[model samples]
Target: MTVTESAQKPEAPANEEQPVVYKSNLEDFEREADVRLPFLLSYREVKLLGIAGVGFFLDAYDLFIINPVATMLQYRLYGGNELPANLEGFVKAGANIGSVIGQFAFGYSADYFGRKAVYGKELMLIIFATIGSICDPTGAISPSGSLIWLGVWRIILGIGIGGDYPMSASVATDRANLRRRGTLLSYIFANQGWGSFVGSLATIIVLLCYKHTMEVDGHTSKVDGVWRILVGLSLIPAFGTLYQRLTLPESTRYAEAQKAAQRVQDEESIEQLKKKANADPGVSEKTKHSSDEEGSGTQTPTVETATAESQSVKAAKELAHAKKGHFKEFFAYFSEWRHLKVLLGTCVCWFLLDIAFYGVNLNQNVVLQQMGFDGSEGTPWNRLFKIGIGNLIITALGFVPGYYATILTIEKLGRKWIQIQGFLMAALFLGILAGKFYTLNTPSFIVCFAFLQFFFNFGANTTTYCYPAEVFPTRFRASAHGMSAACGKAGAIISALAFNSLTKSIGTPAVLWIFVGCCIFGAAFTLLLPEVRDRDPDVVYEQELRERERARH
Candidate 1:
């Protein structure tokens, strides 16, 4: 028997009379197949998940590389002086603005077209944009000119990053087995943590190696090379997976559904021809006469006539369904209370999560410095190792393990409950940081930062990404995630633009307190969402859509 055939074999019920409701169609299979949670992926599922996961790591690496590189740029380009504040804010917000545009455009495209078309194009955009930004004319170009040029390139880069939100999530969702989808999907997003960890480690190693030439002007001129190297490293993963992506098969279930739709259309057309034949006097009379010639034959339409009429009816029903499926599908997701509520709860939680999450990450350097992660006032080598190696340690000890744990236990703890706990914990930690900022010394500060990072990964960071992709229906999943991620990115942009200034003006305590509030709100909002750990994404979504459609009548 085939794998699917094996999967289809059902267990006998304790009570023999209880009937099994085996799935009759691809939609049923699509939903039921996605929930596989135990362990081990099919070879095809693993390949797709790996490609999608790698995309996430690149996204994380690119986003985090700027953290250390920004300091280097200030020293090299601005002559290690206090540069204008507006320029600093502009630099931080450039990519974020681009991300918003990318999410909406590509998210809708994935739904309208297909996931495969949009999947790898983002990586190409990123590779080219990064190259452009690295080679931007530096010497003769005015600051404004460079700003405009860099900003434009960053926006392009943002588009690629934004596109990944829908493309990666949708691809993973499409390929995943239903039972363990949350676990499998979680593994893909876990790369972001690893990416951050690797970026930090790499930045430090590069700085240590190149420390000999480092100068502390407003910008570190020598560090530009390191930034270029950092930007270029992401290309490796992008290119490595490009081949697999080229050969990757579209989701079998999706293909089957499309084929079924096509077959229904073909059958309908043949039926229409039969109906026309049966309606003609000549054909009808001939069919009747032939039927009568068969001894004792009852007066009935000929087999061809009957087949054609049946086909035509089936075809008409299918066409009508196709037409009604379009507008009704979209309207059902929003017009209904249950679905609208789920969507709202998810979007709002994401909005709140991002406010805290991005605010902290955007200002991690400040926290690092506050915790005395700034290398000794002496050698660039020593400072680089301390910050870089510290980040590597966190990735190894904290992020990697935390993510793997989530993946292993998502079935047990459940996505909703886990997320609730994570948000609450994040809130609690932020509260601690806020309460302790002034009173805590270096070690205590480091401890707090570590704790916050732990929960951020273990809780909100990982689950926020996973849940949005899962909760929304397949048809709207990409758009919902795109909107949520875009909203989150917007929060990040706001944090990036305002974080430093806010920390400077109001102090770290106050800034952290704000994050605490957002986290608390996120935690509270998690209660509003359903515990969907057991549900298959596509099935749950389609069923919900169908129910909503029925209610409208």
Candidate 2:
């Protein structure tokens, strides 16, 4: 038997004497889905994961790769001079701005339309915009103009990357078995670390390939190709996964919900028609007899025709009600304080995490400089190689391992505990860095920095993504995840735009102090979220509906 087939719960034999339990259709469907899907990874599940995960890989690559690309641009476009601080901030922040917009727009679209409708379109956007960014017209435009061109394309790329947040998270969460949902999501998110590592590795390899040619005649002309090629390589995975995303089926939960809603609408429509027919004084005996025969299929031809017409009218009314209820039901469902609190917790925690997360990520080179890996005294190629090695070491020591640790332990430790510990530990390390900024030697700094990266991934970063996807009901899961993610990106934008100037004004130590505070607050906010390990979100949603119904009565 297939995994899905083997996972199914055996049905009890029906007995005429025993009355059947009248379960709500939605609840019944949820129960069936829960039984049919298992936590074990089948070939099909892995394929789905890879296809969904490619976007996150690109997101990480496109976002972090800019660091090296920006350095290369400094050489190729500005004659080896650093970009002006303001332009540099804008260029770094452009994609984040686009991401904020995409998250809000795409999140709502996924909830309002269907997940399948919006899944792969964002990947296509990423492919197009990534190509546009790499092909920035350096020769045809002034240096500043070239920067602007790349920034514009990066923003477009950010939008697509942003869409991937909700699309992938929702798709993965919707299909995952309860026992392995967190693990599967962590697996998908772990791709971000890999993407970052690969971006660094790719830059190093490409720089080496062109180092000799660019060094000749003291001209660094070939260095320009390094960033372009790095950015261009992301397109390969994007294209490869596009067909899978486009062809993937809509989530079973969503399909079942629609069916349940239609069944309810049909029942209500038939009941209302019965009441109207009973109350009408002008109804003739013949008309009454025909109405009674509608179900039995023993009516005359004219009566049969009238019954068919009535059924069509009911169908039209049902469709209208479904359309009207779409937005109304969303607002009404979330208006309850209990539901809204989950959203608030997710958004706030994510926001707090990103402020520190992006601040450190986007400005990691500054941290590396403090460790004496700045390569200031070396040739351009030597400098690039050192930077790549530093990044690779950082990823190896911290980012990649942290993500895998979360994957291995997430199901066991519980998301809340891991997130809380991650935040507190991250804060502790940040405090160490802040207090010992100048006093610490190179090895000490690397140790602290590596620990911070490790906890950040193992803690809030992975949990934040996993929680929002799992906590919300299917009707609003995508939208809620999007809003939370968008809020996080907003924090990233603030960090990116303000970090450079903030560092200049208050020094790096003071900035590290601020990040430490953010991490603390992130941990505090995480307390507001419930621990959701191994729980089916649909089951929780059904319980909530029962409670709401009970309160009304």
Candidate 3:
């Protein structure tokens, strides 16, 4: 019976625990979900963020820890000679390369396979790779061999690391309500700041462990233990989330959308059956007319069709679902210029942001030295310790705070404006630093650098991560976000490989100018993105599909 018609008939027993049964109509349910997601915040949301966010925390820890780890490696492995230029570049860029692979691979997998099936597998790769990395027999191998060993395992670890980008983003975005979508995403992305802070803090604490030896021997070989410990600590958070990531239930939003897709599937199947029955020579004209009614594009599930489920039909449906809903669907959705442009914008913006972001960040030691915290004039332990202090100062004053600032302000200011102003402000600082590279005194340069860090997080860095998760439809969200993020990693890879060489060839001032150019162009691309506040990609996609159908009629 129709839900409204049955409503007046009778009531169920009050003693029984009951389903809410509010909206039998799928369209009404979708509408309510859009409103309810933002308003609904509870333990479930917190638990999800807590689990999914670990990947990001690990991401920041591993990515930044390398800074100190590399310094430690310098003393422990090379007796403080600068690492081979090629090996240093590979070590820095390797994880990012793996991230690109993981982003593309997992992004597509989550969308096609459903979030739950593919969710925790990336963590497995991370665990395996992390273990492999720490076990790199540095004492037994040649310097080149040790570097290769570390680089290789990091790349493997990176695959899992990179995969987490799309996997976590999709999981968060899929579960998030429309009202607080930006805030929810920002909370997750902000973990990177803490991850970075913890990495710095960890270095200080670990370095202190062998302070006596460091001071006595200057550049003692015992420093080998330090990098391994930092790399291994990431495993603690990784293991904490592995069980939860594996056990994650399918997203409620994704489940509801699947119901809608199945309803459409049933309507198609019933139409096909009607057409075949009518084509029989013995079939009457009335049956043919009924077939036409069935083919009239009615989307809501009818009582007969909804009840038509049987073991055999379900078996076919499952098989058909597996075969049909893959790449062609993704392609059909993005075939139009309007949709294509958004995907393009996300990719381009993220790519540009990472180019500048990584370019500036990876060169922190250079900036730290300019601020007069250089470890160059000291003993081995003192030199490494001085740079660690520099890293700690930068992380405290700028990097961590900027992310939290975006979290507080993003929902109010809207993503587009924040990204625009962030880019403009960041460009302003980089331009000042680049223009006054030689002339600026210590305090002034640090001020400009700190503000630059502030604006990157407050503006594009956090927002770029948010946009991909928000801008695309559910079925395509993971894949699109993955592609966008992978492109960003590609930018990082280029910068990692080239920045040091570029700094040497053209000079640091010229390199900062290039970053300024990247940041300014990044702002221009921000215009291509929608505000994403109060909007639901799936809800909007449904509306557009209906509008197109109406126009066709």
Candidate 4:
């Protein structure tokens, strides 16, 4: 039934204990949940965050590691010639395409089946796909075939990585206390930086160990081991977190919603029974005496029996509703414009931020060259080592620190203000880089790139993830988060697919100009979103409920 139709049912008789009891219980749960949960992070909260963070860490590692690994594959598969331009973009963007599908599917599933039921299954998919990526055939297939094989596995891996966005965001936001909700989510998301760093660092370490052997061979055969090892190492963390995700209890808020839905069903059932009795006076008199005798024997038993009957009716209704499908309910719930606008703000802001963010990130090799890490001065093995070191250094200077800054001040700065400022500041740096593309010295370029990285994380990137998790009601929170994240990945896919070709056609200066525009538009879109600092979603939902009731009257 539509929410309005359900809400319009006749009020239960004043003497009915079932409706009163359920209302009181639900109110008490909300009061305690809002006031007590947000103030502290206990062991349980830490465990939840850690379990969720692992998926994000793996997501970043699997996605970003492709850059360096693809570089290695070019050497091994194509005799150090540059990978074909079409294949290069396809390989880089494959995971993002898979992630878009995964986000939508898993986001809706999490809401439909309950978070705990679907939480860790994505990790299992990642583990399997990561292993498959490592096993990509070399001699068995032509060069293009090999690249195609790896790309297909990356897409599968991307599906798992994509699922993590909504699953982890919903889990973290649901468990976090109102005061530290932003801080907790930042901690989970900060893992993306660490994942990127570790992916680079791992490649560097493996390359150093194999540098001599690969140099002596004079062919790219041994370099094949490097890509396999780098891809396979991700399996370690995914395996470690699997059991915990599978075992996590459903969020308290979700549990409460299940109870509330049940209460509504019970209220409706009792109303139906009262009408039935009124229509048959003879049966009503007989039933009335029976109830009185039962009540006289024990008032408590009579009340308990009525409450039990209400609960059973609720269960039956819930089952019937379940059979009708969640997608219908999802659209019905979000059909209102006010609710739809919040989803739009989250999706658009993320879309704009990612187009610039991933465009820079996935194509870091271009920026690294500007910083003098282009590997021109050394052998092929040494070039790989320098690239790895360059990635690690840039991540240390810009990426990791930016995420921590957001964690430290997200609550104080508020999501909307920080996102706005981050986008505007990032745009400023992009303009500087574009305007000085040819003239800027290596040190100056590095400084500008560092500032851009800092603001992207400290601003829209973190806030975009946190906002969807906080703004939507629990029933649709996961789906909304997934949709927003999918929009962001769509931006990432566009960057991955188009960055190389765009640079070839327009020159690097023009491309940077486009990114600067994306940042400016991202800032403009930030105006549409609400500030969620210290705000509880449950309280927001209650206020919305009251507003709807007033409109109906």
> What local lDDT score does residue 426 receive in model 4, on the 0 to 100 scale?
94
| Over 4 Å off, model 1 | 1-42, 212-220, 255-328, 379-386, 393-397, 541-553
lDDT against the true structure, per candidate, is 0.69, 0.81, 0.81, 0.81
- Give the distance in Å from residue 254's predicted Cα in candidate 4 to where it truly belongs: 0.5
RMSD of 2: 5.3
lDDT of 3 by residue, 1-553 (tens): 1011100112444753332121222344345556653434445556777877888888888889987888888887887898998898888889999999999999998877788889999999999999999998998989889999999998998999899998988888776655677887888888898899898899888888888876876548888888888899998988888888888777755554554455545555666766777677455466767768777636547646856878668745753474365576678779988889899989998999999999888878889879887688877777777888888888888898899888787877899999999999999999999999999999898888999999999999999999989889776889999999999999999888888889999999999999999999989988888889877777677666656646644
- Give lDDT tens digits, candidate 2, residues 232-253: 9998899888888888767766
Model 3 gets an lDDT of 0.81
Q: Please identify model 3 stretches exceeding 4 Å from their true place.
A: 1-41, 217-219, 262-323
Estimate the TM-score for candidate 3: 0.86
The ten-residue window of minimal lDDT in model 1 covers 1-10
| TM-scores for candidates 1 onward, in order | 0.80, 0.87, 0.86, 0.86
Give the residue spans of candidate 4 off by over 4 A: 1-41, 217-219, 262-326
What lDDT does candidate 3 reach at residue 78? 87
Q: Deviation in angstroms for 53 in model 1?
A: 1.0
Instruction: Encode model 1's per-residue lDDT on 1-553: one tens digit a residue.
Output: 1112111213445874343322323455455455654555655456656778886797778777766665555555676454467765666677778888988888877765556666678778877888887876756787556656777888898898888888888777765555767877888888888788779877876776676666343223666677778777777887888766555545543333333334434555556656876889787677667657754433545545656777657645654454334344557557888777777777778778878887877666666677666554544445545766655655565567667777887878888888888888888878988897778897777766677777777777787788777787665678778887887787788777777878899987898899888888888888878887866555554354345435643
